[model samples]
Target: MEAFDIAGLCAHPDDAELVMGGTLAREAAAGRKVALVDLTRGESGSRGSPAVRAAEAAEAARVLGASHRESLGLPDSALERTVAHRDVIVSALRRLRPAIVVTQHWDQRHPDHGMASHLVYDACFMSGLRNYRPDLGAAFRPRKVVFATSMTETIEAVPSFVVDITATFETKMRAIRAFASQFSPAAGETVALPFERFQESVELTARRQGQRIGVTFGEGFVTREPVEIDDLLALRGRSI
Candidate 1:
């Protein structure tokens, strides 16, 4: 059997890192294979060009030790959950054949976030069907699928799993910092809330989730289906 563990799907260049970089770093440190697939290049982002974004993504992936990272060239905010979109994602899944697929929450402050979540969810299911978009070649279903935490406060998502990432927290910061074009305070670059501000947000989110599960840092994931556990006690050191 193949050993690839996770494929993180996100809408923009840094979305995956922003949401679950700490967890990803922890997984990679444990020798788990992790790949990042960005639905769009963040081409329409308020800051940085496509080339810069691509470079930043590569740098971040290197820091996180991701097995693979690629962008689908999908329209930034104009992405549609269409057959074309589904086919591309399905094809990617068939190629990666990961054990678990991670994506964004269904509802979010940004339209692309919600659309990307729907697209990834539908594509994962469709990738398992034999008759859907046969031109993409073969279909392979993932063992588990989970969505990342969103930035909005109004949405409710009960996490089915959580990864304690306290040890790799600094590595996650390094990965986020590698996106210099976006976070760097260059004169021509777009004004973000400062790199430190963004990092603080990440720190707060991780600490809040970690507190619930008695950890120093963590990343939460909500499963689309019910999670079956062989032993609930195995979760004693983990989170719900």
Candidate 2:
């Protein structure tokens, strides 16, 4: 596969779309090479089988215009921070060599999400080490690692930045809906709640975030390190 500009590394198949769909769509629409790496096949999800979810994920990737979508085959709902697991992620990072990586927030309600956050962060650092895993791929480090909010019941901290995704909001929804097993009642699959309610909640969150930045729709992300701005005028939402 070709190098990606940005990569979304998440715990489960639909996690990326749930949290950063709009951002991914916007990036891909802008002709930036974007990829998604799902840590697991979401086999533990109540609604779908692994095979079913895999197909759904592919559809979602297509809708989002992602350059590549892959799963690490990690145990769902049972993610751990181990050398083997970290090495797998590190290999992918070196192979993709994305300049920026987006992952779930460190503090999350789901254990897998939290674990994935730590795993991705550590792997990013390890990927930079020349001797970490020479057999997998050449050492390469991503420039930035940003955290996107996912399945968190509360917003513990304010976002460091918000990406305006008004133009791609609908496209994001379409990509999310591709996971019919999780969000579509007509798919004859059991879900935690009605599909309509789930959709409404997602839209509501996007709307609230968008309101924060005076946009119709947006996605928020937090960065552990302070973002360096080359020019204030170049920043989004800045008046020329």
Specify the highest-TM-score model's number. Answer: 2
Candidate 2, residues 1-240, lDDT tens digits: the string is 468899999999989998899999989989999999999889998776799999999999999999899998999999999988898899889889999999999888888999999999999999999987699889999999999863466554578888888898888889888898775454565656787888888888888778778887878899998989999878777433
What local lDDT score does residue 73 receive in model 2, on the 0 to 100 scale? Answer: 93
TM-score of each: 0.92, 0.93
The parts of candidate 1 lying over 4 Å away from their true place are: 1-3, 185-192, 237-240
Q: How many clashes in each structure?
A: 0, 0
Question: TM-score of model 1 relative to the true fold?
Answer: 0.92
Off by over 4 Å in 2: 184-192, 238-240
Error of 2 at 13 (Å): 0.5
Residue 185, model 1: lDDT of 64
Q: List per-candidate RMSD values in Å.
A: 2.4, 2.4
Q: Relative to the true structure, how large is the alpha-carbon lDDT of every model?
A: 0.83, 0.88
Task: Give per-residue lDDT, candidate 1, residue 232.
Answer: 69
